[model samples]
Target: MRDENEMEELESVVERMQQGDRAAYEVLLDRFQPSVFRLAHRVTGSREDAWDVVQEVFLCVHRRREELREASRFRPWLYRMAYCQAVDVVRLRSGKRVDAWGDGEEAHAAAPEAGPSARAETNALADEMNRALSALPEKFREPLVLATHGKLSYEEIAGTVGCPVGTVRSRISAARQLLKERLSAWLGND
Candidate 1:
């Protein structure tokens, strides 16, 4: 969570961007691009699609900079745009064959010393987890991803998803329950 000072700084940056400050826009991009990509990836379940979404999102931000009336609300507004853009990509590419999980490059990087068997097991588990997540209904999946990967608060997610905070809470809880049920075998609960 950002402190009060950080939020104020972001608000100032957003205001500057709205006022045509290119430097402020660059700062926003540098700070937010990675998170936007991760959020897009989790939503669309395709790295390529995520990249596409990120491009579209920043473009939208640049074009629609003046649409943001309250600078303090920039984060959720930006997330909403990214989320909607990712949903569009998913809808457009629904039938295309793409990797449902990202390449396990990050996982491999984290455990470079692991033996071959360990890596294989890790990859298998990650594949299963990804499959389970993909199986979730979009309503549940979106909020869960926003919370876990995007690291948005319930209120922030509510604003991004245009839902009540209580609904966001319920959806995230339901998503966790569903994932647990789907992965019960791997969890040794079967």
Candidate 2:
């Protein structure tokens, strides 16, 4: 979710959008495109599919704009929509029940100022982390990603994930514990 000031601004934009203001919708798209894309990519594990999710989500939102009752809650509502769409894409591709979670570290890797050896090490660590994250069960992975990468508050994560706050907290804690165990050797704690 956005900061307090941004949230207030977003509420205003959402109000205008609900009233069928195209420019307001454009502002919303610009502000949230990166977040939506990142969530989609984290869930779908493919940039192409993430783009598809973004388009599909916004289209759905636009079509159902009037269904939105509270503009202040738009962030979680958007995330919920994106999550559902990404899950649908994964299900279609795999023909199985699994939540998407993978490969977000590439975007946050160290800058090019790092030496070649350092860069290689960073890349290797990132790869290992991605693998560990992807291996987590859906219940744990979803909450972890929403909290850490999505920067959602516990309450917001609960709303988006359709779980109670306690459940969200437990899942995030368990996800971290599992990741630590999986990466113990690489982290030199074994």
Candidate 3:
């Protein structure tokens, strides 16, 4: 219900987009860039990689605007594209086809960058949280980020991930459990 306003705004942009309004797409980009980059950042675990992932995401979305059926779910749809784009970037870098069930660590999902900071304790905790997230399997990481940070619903996540709604719920539940166990201090209320 709340997202209606967001959808309405995006719909206007998408309509203009459909009418070949390049400017409208730019507006859309401005609106969603923060969330898109965050999703990319989580997936790639690097600011630079995330930036590249976002550019790819927008390009892919722009190319596929004709295929969008649910503007109300624009945010999730955008996220799915960002997710796939991140995966693609990682695969291209590694020069291998991504097997979803790949061994462990997935390496590229390594911790996001953090340098010497004025607040060492906070920096250390942030680094630890990222490491905990990095240790998670990709299946869990994507669902958790998309659901918790992306603020996507189970149904919307199901659509984005091309999975059943129940599966989305189960995956998010499993991810939450893992985070609770591994990042108890950072997460709090374990």
Candidate 4:
């Protein structure tokens, strides 16, 4: 679970982003791009425009964030925005809306061409993590990334989730427990 301080940081970042602060937007982008890009890539199945969808998400947020009054809900609200943008891009491109969480076989079909050993290690890790992360429900996965990978605190996660702090803690706890049960064998008990 997350601590309580991240909300302050997120609030400040959101304030800066709302003020047309390019630096602040850059910070937000840097912080959240992995999860955002992963989500976009999973949805679109196009490595090329997965980046495009990420850009569009922020652009749309920049354009419409002013409409939101509550500062705390910025996190989840932004994700919802990104989700809509990614889906729209996919629909427009493929002439069909993909309802799956990721592209299935096509999702990771664009593996980088590289030496066999290097690719093997990277792909092995990717395969395990992707499978574990994707196994969790969207509710769990979203908060898990926000707390661990994004390093957001419980209060901040609550804001993003529009839920109580307790709920954030419980969900993150459950997510970690599940991942540990599934991954601890490979990682060892250390």
For every model shown, the clashing-pair count is 0, 0, 0, 0
Candidate 3 overall Cα lDDT vs. reference?
Answer: 0.72
Candidate 1 structure quality by residue, lDDT tens digits, 121-147:
888888888889888998998888788
lDDT of 1 at 134: 80
Q: Which candidate, 1 or 4, would have the higher lDDT against the true structure? A: 1
| Clash total of candidate 3 | 0
**Residue runs of model 1 more than 4 Å from their true location after superposition:** 95-102
lDDT against the true structure, per candidate, is: 0.87, 0.82, 0.72, 0.70
TM-score of 2: 0.81
The order by descending TM-score is 1, 2, 3, 4
Q: Sort every candidate by lDDT, greatest first.
A: 1, 2, 3, 4
RMSD of 4: 7.1
Model 1 gets an lDDT of 0.87
Q: What is the lDDT of residue 31 in candidate 1?
A: 97
Considering summed lDDT, which 10 consecutive residues are worst modelled in model 2?
95-104
Stretches of candidate 2 exceeding 4 Å from the true structure: 1-4, 95-124
Which model scores highest in lDDT? Answer: 1
The residue pairs that clash in candidate 3, if any, are none
- After superposition, which runs of candidate 4 have C-alpha atoms over 4 Å from their true positions? 1-49, 71-76, 83-122
- Writing each residue's lDDT as its tens digit, candidate 2 over 1-190 gives 5677887888999999999999999998998889999888877777888899999999988998998899988988888888779878977887432323445344335365677777777767766777788789989988888777577899999988889999999999999999999999888988
**TM-score (C-alpha, index-matched) for candidate 1:** 0.88
| lDDT by residue for model 3 (125-184), tens | 556666676677877778877886666888888888888988888888887788678878
Candidate 2 vs candidate 4: the TM-score winner is 2
